[model samples]
Target: MLAAMNRHRADGKAGEPVLTHRFLCPASAVSNLRDRLRPQEPWRLGLIVDVELSDLPHVLDAVAHDTRLELETVELRLPGKDRPAHAVDAARAPLGSTDASTYLELAPASPAVPDTLAACADRGFGAKIRCGGTTAAAFPTAAQLAGFLLAAVGLAVPFKATAGLHHAVRYQDPVTGFKHHGFLNLLVAVCHAVEGADPKEVEAALLIDDGPTLAARARGVPDHTATRARQLFVAYGSCSTSEPVDDLAGLGLLESRLA
Candidate 1:
């Protein structure tokens, strides 16, 4: 993955690589992770780990030495239902001097999402949402996702999404027939949320399935609105790098050399 990113960066064809590497590892594996950390350019890195790991501080300390990788954020995996303030406090206890931002991963279906996002805003932490997974149950309904977006916007809390957003527009896989949310759909929804659109309107954006229509909506977003939206919806994870570029090119939103 790093090699492919480097090649793209060198070619300067597809634009700068906004690639990130997120991993799940134990504190004991810090040495192994250090050995594997080699990036040609500065790249954002995220670590998903248990909040109660014993050697987390040491692991973070070791990771901070790598100038090539920026420790963008550390995601805390809560063991069970806990108060948001308490969870953030516990996660911060282990970080002695490491300055990486912290975020609490919230399930989209959890009823406590709104309150948790509020706490994140109060405590200077970000939020993470799971957009999709292997099973159909992992994907949140349009209404559910809209609720999350609205709450995050209202609280002024930044967030990043992970999993299942491979294409630029919402699509149903022909092989599995599972519906997947599009990153572009999410971007347009963010624009709506930032502009104080109601939940129904935001949900409508998420439910858009037509590629051209969705692409037009994304393109129509005003530059200022798009900037504000991106400030709140910081980043998202995608499984395939080429898939998004291909989708945007196909939608006439980007230039591509692919035939």
Candidate 2:
């Protein structure tokens, strides 16, 4: 993803936050990170580290050796069954006054997710949703997606999404056969959320596949509404940036050079 972004920058400088990499407590992580950094790439924006609560100390110890200094964001993935507040407190201790923003990613199926989201919002931490996965079960149902986004909207908290989003509009993968959410679907759904759209309405937007219709709806969004929608939806992770960019170009959402 970072490589694609670097390839696209007209000035040849990295200018966007691409994705987050989990930091394991192994010795190899240090060397792996060092090898990952390249000259003139926006290393900070390209990859943020996600640290598990129990591994925070170990990760901190390992990172102390790196010259990267402060991380852009140290995402704390909360323990699946622990109390939200307890987990937040434990995660906060290791961060200790760093300039990096804190983001919390957790399972939406957890009964306490809403409460945990509230706690994260109160602390100004961003929220993350695992949208889809390599398998079908990893994907959240429309109800689940709507519920989480609606809850975030009510709390005025920003959120990011990951996995299963590889196209501009919803479609089934030819090889894997798993149905995936579309980035445009999500952006439009987010615009609805920003304008206080109901969960069903947001869900409706997610399931739409008509390319021109969806593009028209996206274009209809007012500039101010688009800004607010972007504020809440933030960004998402795509395995191939070109796939989505190409999809958008094909759909006329983006200008095509070949046209």
Candidate 3:
């Protein structure tokens, strides 16, 4: 999951969450997602709509009549059959276009990416990245997304993620069919990247083959891992936190960093 860092305009003060045009594939729960997050706490209700190629029309219908809609981000999945370009258009059409807050998830492309980096540059849409789960962080995983980021930080293609980010540790969820959250890994990697870590290392951290080795090295950073991490998610997601994120700002250690 790439961090969404807002840029500071000439004024010096950081601006709003830069809404990107990219749409994450398969948006999460829309209607009652927030109420579901924490039953006890006070939270604003928002929707995370899914925009599959086949489901685009349906989503349009749902949101068309309803102008007072509250949404986080529309995630688009690039299935073997779904045309990524078309989906991007559909997702962006609803969004106001040029909203950097928007993001897209980059699942492994089928047939061939046809120059994914170039495609992203050409399309000028958000390319969501899968950094965890069965998705490899390199070549076709987070590495690919990182490439987009590293190569085009000035270009402005944003990212969003889902699935596989549950625990903040290196594990797999049979239910979700992706690697569970390796919290420490995410924190270190993001921080490293923020601090100017090489893309190769970020890609290495996202690889399954290299996970064990990375995990061994990560044992030391548990206190900073973002697994079930609070505050940060709230700060980032903006929807209120339930279990994973409630007070991340005050909390010192993440699941991995807790020790």
Candidate 4:
């Protein structure tokens, strides 16, 4: 990945996209990953730790070795199926002093979601949601997702999403039959949530499956609203870069030249 980034920088084409890398690993492996990634200096690196086997302070110390590497978020994975709020409270003391964000991979349908999001906001941490995964169970229903958005926005907590958002429009896989959340749908939903739209209207945006209709709504978002929406949504992870760009260009949302 560093080699690819270096090559892209070497090309030096006008208006070339900036490349960044996000590494997801266990807390114990952070030091090793930092050592391996240190040679590539001045790169924007975001780290997401999935498990907390090691001390968080140690993990933060490892990230400190590389000035460019940021400990973006640490996932609180408690055993024995503890509540999400418990996990958030357990992390407050150790993570309180650091600027690194913390999140729990809690399902929006979980009864603990509202309290968990509230706890996260109280501690200055962000929320993380799984948009989709290999299994159908990983996908949250439209209403569940909308409820989460409304809660997070009301609390003024930023959030990040991961997995199964490679496409621009909502779709169900023909083979696996797992419905995927559209990145475009998420963007519009965030805009509505920030604008104080009602819950039903926000959920309606997520339920829209027509590509042209969703694209038109995305284009209709004003610049200021989009910027404010992004501040709350923060970031989302996708496996393929070209797939989303292609989808956006095909929908007339992005310029063909950029694609």
Per TM-score, the best of the predicted structures is 1
- Structure candidate 2, residue pairs in collision: none
Instruction: Extract clashing residue pairs from model 1.
Output: none
Per-model TM-score versus the true fold:
0.85, 0.80, 0.47, 0.83
Q: Assess candidate 2 and give its lDDT.
A: 0.69
lDDT of 3 at 37: 32
Give the per-residue lDDT of model 4 (tens digit) for 129-160. 88888788888999999999999889988888
- Residues 1-259, candidate 1: write the lDDT tens digits: 3454454445354452443344334455556655655655454567766435666876787778777666767776543577866766665677676777776778888888888788788878889888888899999999999999999999999998878899888889998888999898998998999999999999999999999899889889999998999899988866566677677878877634433
Write model 2 residue lDDT over 65-150, tens digit each, in one string: 45553355555566546688777666577665665666677676667778988888878787888878867889887777878888
Residue 91 of model 3: what lDDT? 51
Model 2: ten consecutive residues of lowest lDDT? 16-25
For model 1, the local distance difference test gives: 0.77
Error of 3 at 133 (Å): 5.5
| Candidate 4 residue 55 C-alpha distance from true site, Å | 3.7
Q: Whole-model Cα lDDT per candidate?
A: 0.77, 0.69, 0.41, 0.74
Please say which candidate is ahead in lDDT: 1 or 2.
1
Report the CA-based lDDT of candidate 4 relative to the real structure: 0.74
Q: Rank the candidate models, highest lDDT first.
A: 1, 4, 2, 3
The segments of candidate 3 whose C-alpha lies over 4 angstroms from its true place after superposition are 1-58, 79-101, 108-114, 121-124, 131-155, 171-184, 194-196, 203-243, 246-259
